[model samples]
Target chain A: MTISFTDAKSLNHDQLEEGTAFAPRFDAHGLITVVTLEDGSNDVLMVAHMNAETLSLTLESGIAHYWSRSRKAIWKKGETSGEMQEVIELRTDCDQDCLVMVVRQTGRGAACHTGRKSCFYRKVIMTDGTASLEDTGLPRLFDPEAVYGG
Target chain B: MTISFTDAKSLNHDQLEEGTAFAPRFDAHGLITVVTLEDGSNDVLMVAHMNAETLSLTLESGIAHYWSRSRKAIWKKGETSGEMQEVIELRTDCDQDCLVMVVRQTGRGAACHTGRKSCFYRKVIMTDGTASLEDTGLPRLFDPEAVYGG
Candidate 1:
């Protein structure tokens, strides 16, 4: 049988605080934020969102799935880029509004569509009263143009 | 002089892709997401938001600051709980709308108001068509009532 979540709004503090139930609180948009991290290294890979369907799929398949608000669809990570994330552990915060997933990234080990190991490839720099971005110089593991086509 | 960001709406692919300028595209709420992780352990401590003022304060002071959307105020983390986060590095995502901060958590090393080392203290459980939260059993580093005053 597939897993399901409890309605957070209907649960009491005692039930929420002490009960061992998966009660995820989705926003009005029917989405919850999920942060993915590379397991061994604990490096953040990407930050995305998940709808109930995607969340259930991730739990059932042991793979990472996300809700693409931009495309308004469910995205099976690495379905096209071959960079799948195998879930090692999934944890929820106090209110269960956010999720953190520890996973072993398969294939190219790149999480960003740009082929970088991480989506965050730059740092902010303040110079002469201006703020700018400076590349961290992380090398791309794959050629995006070759994989996704320009 | 105070640093400012360019309006993301006015920038094109070339300007956004190749330019060094920092143009954070805040959502309609005038807020951007910020995730905090412990510097050495790399465990995610908390996920919060930043308004322009708090973001600038974090950049200028090297202290992690956040916007409390519920309280509608600027919060200097650890001010009440003594769990200040000293920024070791600050990074922005490829598009500059999200941020990740690696910090050295001060005082008791707890980042959660729940008195836990990290805010994520539970994992979801799915068994026999039932779903619930299982406490990760991370010890409470402090007493919330004592720190915040009951």
Candidate 2:
């Protein structure tokens, strides 16, 4: 069955922001940004994008699905690896241009392709007019090579 | 003085993903996605965009700056409402295409234009075959009309 969303074009500012309608304003690429966070820790695991189909699949199956920009296809996350995410809660921002998803990380609890629990493992540091990065010392939970196989 | 970044074009995959270089990969529109979170509660405040100029300004001032897509200009957040955000930490994803900022919401302790502590005040509810939204019961910390002046 095909699922559809309320047309955001028809909603006024107040209705869109304050009302209960689920009209997501997809960007020109037919995608909306999604920020995924681990449910227990509330740590941001990854940031990804989803098209209407993946969004429906996510809501229907209670699993996280995303649109891989580089691959130009629907990505059932953890299909290749064993890091599936169980959706606990899904939220939309006021303007409905972005989404926040709380999920329970399955398998080895890794949420990044680099085998880390979170994609955001490095903090930006600015010193003497130059900016660099410092690792937060988050250790990898799994081996990407063994899981993804080059 | 103009701040510059280590051009992402010069970085290889390993250098960009695993190295310490702060090479942010801006999208085709010369903007990168930013996710802001409250420092203590860790609730997502808002999702925004940042160009090189706003990115530099944010780092230089230790305050949050964003690219206002609607206004087509640099937005010094809280400039109008006194809810300025003092960035506590800035982080980049493994691919450097997205950013996470931990901030202390000043003034009225609100981080949303709607006068709420968070822009993500509603949760998406999928029941049966339909989807809608349910408010999270987060009360507005300030009045928009009195602050912004209708």
For candidate 1, lDDT tens digit of each residue in B53-92? Answer: 8888888888998999889999999999889999988888
Residue B34 alpha-carbon offset, candidate 1, angstroms: 0.7
What does candidate 1's lDDT look like per residue over A120-139, in tens digits? Answer: 88878877667788888878
The DockQ figures for the candidates are 0.72, 0.83
In candidate 2, which residue ranges exceed 4 Å CA deviation? none
What is the per-residue lDDT of model 2 for residues B25-54, given as tens digits with 9 covering 90 to 100? 999999999999999777899999999999
| Top-scoring candidate (DockQ) | 2
- Identify the runs in model 1 with alpha carbons over 4 angstroms from their true place: none
User: What pairs collide in candidate 2?
Assistant: none
lDDT of each: 0.86, 0.93
Residue pairs with clashing backbones, model 1: A20-B132, A20-B133, A21-B131, A21-B132, A21-B133, A22-B131, A22-B132
